[model samples]
Target: MHPLPQLESYAIRTFEIDCNQQLTIPALVRLMQETAMQQVLELNISVWDLEQYSLAWVLIRKRIEIERLPMLGEKISIHSYPTGADRVFTYRDFRVYDEAGQQIATAATTWLLMNLQTRQMSRIPAELLARFSGYFPPVEMALPYALDSLPPMEQAFTSRNYVVGWYDLDFLKHLNNVHFVKWMLEALPEETLAKQQIRRMDLLFLAEGNLHDRIDAQFQQIDEATYLHQLVRQEDKKVLATGRTIWV
Candidate 1:
């Protein structure tokens, strides 16, 4: 049973805050993702290492529940560990705590190792999975399920379209998951953002986007503060990602 790796003493910077003066959903998600990357690198397997075998890691699904968004200048600690792997899916857990040690947020994410050249799921090496040994944290809840198809809209409540550029790509040469959340948030009117704070989010990545790929982003309100979002390939209309966010 190996101890979970942790990124501690993170100071919430002013630049990381949203209009509401608290950590933004995209920023928080980025921190967790960075933590996961660090965990794997500590095991002596970097993204370039995976690339040598024509492999890359892709996030399949994520569910984040934030009890209280940390504010500017607060020092926090993030702990994460690979819970286990099943087939081609690897599950990981994350916990965030305030300076006083009070828990503030938790997340569970599923990732898949894939053949970059073929875009097919790849099996994780036994040695790679063995490093985790005995660090299996119980999931706070079931991981998010795949999003249902978005119902047809007379027109997108709010939509944005743009081409994928170099800045949008991660090491995998595809849209970074945090940017998906950022684009979704950007679709909302300024007034809506000023009045609400995102508290829960579930995202599922359906397809990958390549450099110069044109993306059509759409947002539709599900209720007062819940919205459904989708990103599609403009040329083929293939859905790239779908997500739902709940705000308070």
Candidate 2:
């Protein structure tokens, strides 16, 4: 068997940066995910292949820690590989560095295999497990805790409704997970974004939102820089996603 490929390089585009000239959280999340997907596809188990097996990769939890967001016009090299699996959950680690070789961020994410037909969790296949059997580096940074479970705080904060736009849909025909992070950050107070930078962020996707779904977003300020947010469908009040952000 060929050794699994382990790293990829990406350019930091001007549109990917924020007003401060640093990479935005949504763009960073997209990069990490794209790198991982590319690595997996190169290993022969492409998304189309998984679909043929009636399987799909569903992201359950993700956490990222940033020492410093890379600036625009820089190149980033990302190193990533599957760490291991636990029953139905497969874990992966990503480490990013600037062109100068300075560490920028580290992230670890958990994914669950889903039975595409039934829409339920599925067990790991033997062949899939064997692919990651040998020699991979351990996660160097501390794995972050899962996002906290939060109660509805509607009375404390005003909620705003947003229409899922055509641009928000991905190949999956649903709102891309990174856009949930984007919406959560956009819902924050302007002063908060101006003064604080995200040190860590955790997100849990509970349900999928389709085009035309009305999403109600509500946020609560835990403190000056920490916040908890929730997004849900307005029709049935079904929860869509929850996120917790820590800023410094």
**Candidate 1 residue-wise lDDT, 68-129, digit = tens:** 99998888898877776777888777889999999899887788888877879999877766
| Candidate 1: regions farther than 4 A off | 138-158
Enumerate residue pairs that collide in model 2.
Answer: none
Clashing pairs in 1: 1-134
lDDT of 1 at 115: 87
Q: Report every candidate's CA lDDT.
A: 0.78, 0.79
Clashes (backbone N, CA, C under 3 Å), per candidate, total 1, 0
Tens-digit lDDT string for candidate 2 (1-248):
33354688988899999899988999998998888888787766656768777887888787878998888888999887776677988877888999889888988788888887898999989887676645344445335434455445544354577899999987667898888888888888887887788898777888888999998887888777778888878899987887778999
Top candidate by TM-score: 2
